[model samples]
Target: MTFKANWEKADKQYFLSAEIIEEMVRRAYTPKKLSSWSVIAGGCANLNIKINFEGNKLPSILRVYLRDKKSAYHEQKLGTLLKGTIALPETNYIGDYKGYRFAITSFIPGIPLRDLLLSHETYDMDSILFKVGGLLAKIATCPISKDLVRIPANSNGNSGFIRMAVPV
Candidate 1:
């Protein structure tokens, strides 16, 4: 019962009003109206929304940091550390709107990994899992300085956006 209540509250707290999304779109891209937007399923941590801009050159995702901004910083840092090493999208902007920390990232166009993994025998499961294990091991062994989690007052990374990262 308590878990249900807590989840219900999270549902409420994480909602994004159209006005807020409009502002996010304007700042991240041009001042164009949103063609459509939808909540991405699966994640239990942060909330990701897929938004369509009428004629955007590339699709984009809006990630709302739930739980805390520290997690947001961690994710952004991981994206930086793993770029080119993995298949994650590029982050365009990281900022706050009405107190919620958010990021705008280029959407990677592909089928979900889970679907691909389960859909066919064409994939080498063992090799894939081994590679994934190696990646996780690398992340686990990597030294995370206090700086990795420390929110810099005004820092930038390949940055098109200002620094408002939250400290871990």
Candidate 2:
């Protein structure tokens, strides 16, 4: 979808009324630079914005809350604390005024693994399978602990395979 259309879609989903948006811009925008702005890939929960200021690029991911203050605060706190400890995106900036809060983050590189696998033209008879296996093992062994965060009992952690344990 077009960028404006995508922003509108995100606004509707996140309950961002035009009045609210105008107010946010008025409060946040400055003549030389916008306090916050938009990025290329705008996500559902957060609208990513890249701002150019004084010849330095200050890119930020803007998270528009669908609800009131408390929900936004909780989301920001949890999200900020969880950064680096886990493999999630990093939050760089946070701002709240006029009942709307936004978050900014540094974008990461690398295409999705699913896309990579799907884009492969053919399955090689050589080391392709071995490389895939190694990648899977690396992902599986990534650091995780209950102390770090609670893993919901219902969550399958994005697994598509049948889960089974073979005792050694």
- What stretches of model 2 exceed 4 Å from their correct place? 1-36, 39-42, 67-89, 109-168
lDDT of 2 by residue, 47-98 (tens): 4344434454544334565344454456554444444333555655456756
Provide the lDDT at 74 for model 2.
Answer: 60
| Cα RMSDs, all models | 8.3, 11.0
How does candidate 1 score on lDDT? 0.69
lDDT of each residue in 1-168, candidate 1, tens digit only: 012322323453367788888787777777676788888865556788898888776668998887688776677876775554566887788888788888888898876555556464587768877988987775565445645542232444533222233354
Clash count, one per candidate: 0, 6
**Range of the 10 consecutive residues with the lowest summed lDDT in candidate 1:** 1-10
Clashing pairs in 2: 37-49, 38-49, 38-50, 39-48, 39-49, 61-104
Q: Which has the greatest lDDT?
A: 1
